[model samples]
Target: MRIIDAHQHFWDLEANYLPWLTDKPVNFRYGDYDAIKKSYLPADYRQDAQEFELAASVFIETEWDPTDPLGEVAWVNSLRKRESLPSVMVAQAWLDRDDAESVLAAHGQTDFVRGIRHKPKAASAPGDVVPGAPGSMGDPAFRRGFSMLAANGLSFDLQTPWWHLPEAADLAEAYPNTQIIINHTGLPADRSDDGLAGWRAALMRAAECPNISIKISGLGQKGKPWESAENRPIIRDTIEIFGADRCMFASNFPVDSLVGTFSTIFNGFRDAVEDFTPGEQQALFHDNAARIYRIDPTREV
Candidate 1:
C-alpha cells in the first residue's frame, strides 16, 4: 500500500543544535566522534522506507532548544539544502512565543515544513517524563503558536508524556479548529502506570474531534513487548477509539529502532490490524498522513 510516514527526525553534529545527541543513546548519534553515526538524510529514510513503499513523510524536530527558534528552523531547512530530504519538517519552535508568526515564517521559507511539536512531557533533563510541564499543545504562548499554524494551514505534531493526555485533550477541546495529530497514540504503555487509564479516555475523546489525527508510531520504540497475542488488543482499542481515518503510521526511526527494527516495527503494526479492512490499513500506512500533512507521497524527494 502507498504510505506517508508523518514523523521522522534528522540531526548533524556539525550543526549548533545537535550537541544534544551526545546525551542520546549511542544508536542515535548522527555525526559525533566516538559514537555510532546516523546517515539520516532523505536518502537514508528513503532507503529504509523503500520496503514499505512510502510515498512521502512528515519530519518532526528531535531537538527542542526553545532559546533559538528561528535559528533552529533555518538549521533544519539548511539540511534540505545540503541534500534531498523526503519529508516535511515539523519545527519545535516557540508556539508559545509572542513572535510565533515570525518563527513559522522562517520555516515557511522551506518546502518541507509541515508542523510543530515541543513535547511538554520532556524532562528539563533527559531520560524521564516531567509531570505538569507546559508542552506546546496548551501553553498560552503555544496558544498563539497553534493559531499561527492554523492560519498558515499547518498541522501540530503533538508529543506528550502519558500523564498530560487529559490536559492535551482539554486543549483539543478548547481549540476545535486546530489540526492536532497525536504522537504515539499519546504513548500508551503495555503496563499501565501514572493514571494511564484516565489518559486513554482523554485520548479517546480527543480522537472524536474530527480535526485531530494520531500517529501510530513510537510506542514499541519506547521499549515494550507484546509477550503474547494478548497484548495485541491495545492496537485494536486504539483503532476502535480513534478510528482508522484519524490514525497514520510512522517509524519514529532510530529512536523506535532502539527497541525494534524498521521492518519489525512496521510489521508489528500490520500484525496489530490484520483483521481490519484493507482501506483501514491503507489509511494507517499512508493516506492519513498525506491528507493531514498535505504532502504527496508521489512527489520527488
Candidate 2:
C-alpha cells in the first residue's frame, strides 16, 4: 500500500550534537538503544522503507542541540533539497523559552516546517500517572509559546505519555483554532489491561476535541516486541475513538528500528488495519498524513 510516513527522524551525528547519540545521558524509554545511535539520514530511511511503497514522510525533530533549534531545521531542509522523501518538517522549539516568539518566527521562515514539537515529557517514576514535568504544559510561559503557533501558522506535535492525555484534551479545547497532533497513540506506556483501559478512556476524552488528532506511531518504544496482532486493539481503538478522519499512521523509524525493521513496523500496521475498507486503509497510510502535514503532491508511490 502507498504510505505517507507522518513521523520519522533524520539526524547527522557529525553535523549536530545530539545528546541521545553522543556522550550524555539519554531519556529514551527503551533499553539498549546503542544499535541506532549512529546517524540516520534520508538514504538510510529510504533503504529501510524500500520494502514498502513510501510516498512521502515528515521529519519529526530529533533531540538536537537545543541551543540552535533552527540549525537542525536547516540541516533537515538541506537533506530535503537532496532527497525529496521527507516532504514536511516538524521542527523543535522550547515553548517555555522567554524569546520563544523569535524562535517560532525563525521556524516559520522555513519552507517545509509545518509544525513544532516542544518536548513535554520529563523523567518520572515508573507507573507514575503523569510522566515528565507535569506543569510544563500548563505553565504560563509555555502556554504563551503555544499560543504563538496559530499566529505563525504552525501546528503542535504533543509528545506526552498517556497520563497527560486529559490535560492535552483541555489544552486542545483551549486552543480550538490551533491543531494538536497527539504523538504515539497518546503514548500508552503501560500495556497491562488496566493501563490500556486508562489509555483508551483518555484517548476518547482527547478525541472529544475536534482539533486534536492522533498519530499512531512509536508503539515499540517501551520494549514491547513488534507484533501486529498484539497492536490491533490499540490501533483499532485509537481509530474508533478519534475516527479514521482524525488519525494517521507513521513509521516512527530509526527509533522504532531499535525494536524491529521497517517492514516489521509498517507491515504490522498494515495487518492491524486489514479489516478496514480500502479507503480507510488509504487514509491511515497516506491521505490523512498528506492532508494534515500539507504535503505537496510528488511522484506516485
Candidate 3:
C-alpha cells in the first residue's frame, strides 16, 4: 500500500547542532539513543524504509539549537531542494519566546513549511499540572503567539503527554481555525489499566475538538520490541476516538529504531487495523497525513 509517513526526522550531527544528540547525553524516554546519534539523512531513511512503498514524509523539527529556529528550516529547505523527500516540514517555533513573531513570519514565508512544533511545559505527573504556568499552554504569552498561526496558514504540532490533553482541548477550542495535530498519541507510555483509562479519557476530550488530529507514531516502549498484541488496543482506541479521517500513521523513525525495525512498526500498524475497511486503512496509512500535512502525494518529492 502507498504511504505518507506523518512523522519522521533527519539530522546531520556533524553539519548541524542538535544539543540532545551532539552534546552530553541527557536522559531519553526511549532509553539509550547513542545507536542513532550519527547522521540520518535522506539516504539513511530511504534505506530503512525500503521495505515499504513510501510516497512522501513529514519532517518534524528535531530539537535543533533553540537560538536558531530559522536555521533548521533553512537547512531543511536545502535538503528538500537536493533530496526531494520529506515532501513538507513542520519547523520549530518557541511560541512563548520574545522572537516568536519574526521567527513565525520567516517560517510562514518558506514554501515547504506547513506547520510549527513547540512542546508546551508539562508537569511531571497528572496531579502536578499547574494551569496557566508561565510557559504552559494556558500562558497568555504562549497563546498570543499561537493565535498568529492561523494568519500564516500553518498548523500546530503538539507533543505533550495525555494528562495535558484537557489544556490542549481548550487551546483547540479557543483557536478553532488553527489545526492542532497531537504527536505520539499523547505519549501514552504508561500501559497499565489505570494509565490506559486516564489516557483514553484525556484523548476523548481532545477528540471533541474538530480542529484536532493525531499521529499514531512514537508508541515505542523503552527496552521493549514493537509488538502488535501490545499496541493494537492503543491503535484501535485512537482510531475509534478520532475516527480514521482524523488519524494518521507515522514511523518516528531512527528514534523508534531503538525499539523495532521500520517494518516492525509499519507492519504492526497495518496488522492492528486489518479488520477495518480498505478505505479506513488507506486513510490511516496515507490519506489523512497528506490532507493534514498538506502534502501532495502525486508531487515528485
Candidate 4:
C-alpha cells in the first residue's frame, strides 16, 4: 500500500543533530538515527522504502536540544531547502514554559512543524519511557502549556508509558481541542512489573478519548527475545481496538531499526494493519497524516 510514515526521526550525523548522538554515559547515542544513515533521511528513507510504497514520512524530534529548542524545526526547515523532505515534524518544547504559546506559535510558522513531544514517563525504569522519568507529565504546568497547542493549530505527540494512562487521559480531558498521539504503545510498560494486562488496560482507555490517537509503530519491538510477528500483535490489538480512524501507521525508523530493518518495521506495521481494508490502509498510511497534520503534499515547501 502507499505509505506515509506518521512517526519517524532523522538526525544529521555531521550537522546540528550530531551532539545528541553521543555514548550512553553522557548522551543516548547508541545505534540510533545518525548511526544508521541508511534510511534516516528523505532520500535514504525513500530508498529504504523501496521494498514497500512509502510516499512520505513525518519526522518526530529525536530529543530535546537545550541550546536550540527549535533544533528539530531548523532541521526540517533546512531539508525543505534541499528537498521536499519530512512532510511533517513532531518537534519538542518545554511545555512548562509560560511562553509556551509564543514558542509554539513561532515553531508552528515553520512549514513542517506540525506536532509537539514533551517526554513523559508513566512507568518504572528499565522501561522505554526515558527522557522524562516518573510523573514528569503529571505537572499541572505542563498541562497548561498543552492547552495552547491546538489554539496554535499544532498537535501534541505524547511519549509516555502505558502505566501513565490516567495521566495521558487527564491531558486529553484537560485539552479537549488538542490532538494527542500515544507514542510507542505507551512505551510497552514494564514487562517485569506493570505487565501486559495493565498496559493493555491503559491502551483501552487511551482508545476511548476522542481527541487521542495512536500511532501504530513497531519502534519498541525489542527488549524481548520475540520477533516482529510477536510484537505486531500488541500494536495490532491497539489498532483493532482503537479502529482505523483513530489509528495511524509510523516507522519510528532508526530507533526501531535497532530492533529490525526499516522495511521489517514497516512490514510489521503493515502486518498489524492487514485486516484493514484498502481504504483503511490508505487512511492509516497516508490520509490520516495528511488530514491530522493538515499536510499539503502539493505545497512547494
Task: Count clashes in each candidate, considering only residues at least 3 apart in sequence or on different chains.
Answer: 6, 1, 1, 0
Q: CA shift at 201, candidate 3, in angstroms?
A: 0.2
The window of 10 residues in a row where model 1 has the poorest summed lDDT is: 27-36
Per-residue lDDT of 237-256 in model 3, one digit per residue for the tens? 99999999999999998899
Candidate 2 global CA lDDT score: 0.83
RMSD of each: 4.6, 2.2, 0.9, 3.8
Q: Write the per-residue lDDT of candidate 1 for residues 56-104, one digit (tens) a residue.
A: 6676876746677656667666665666464567877666656778877
Global local distance difference test of model 4 = 0.70
Candidate that scores best on TM-score: 3
The segments of candidate 4 whose C-alpha lies over 4 angstroms from its true place after superposition are 17-19, 23-40, 121-135, 189-194, 219-226, 299-301
After TM-score superposition, the amount by which residue 8's alpha carbon in candidate 3 deviates from its true location, in angstroms, is 0.5
Q: Relative to the unseen true structure, what is the Cα RMSD of model 2?
A: 2.2
Q: Candidate 3, after superposition: displacement of residue 192 in Å?
A: 0.8
Residue 217 displacement (Å), model 4: 1.0
Supply the global lDDT for candidate 3: 0.92
lDDT of each residue in 1-301, candidate 2, tens digit only: 7788999998888778887689865547767778777888878988898888788888898978888888888788777778875788899998988779999998887778999999675435335644224346766777888889998989999997776777777788888989999998887877889888888988988989999998998887456677876777888899999998999998788888877889998888888888899999999899998888888886333
Superposed on all Cα atoms, model 1 deviates from the true structure by an RMSD in Å of 4.6
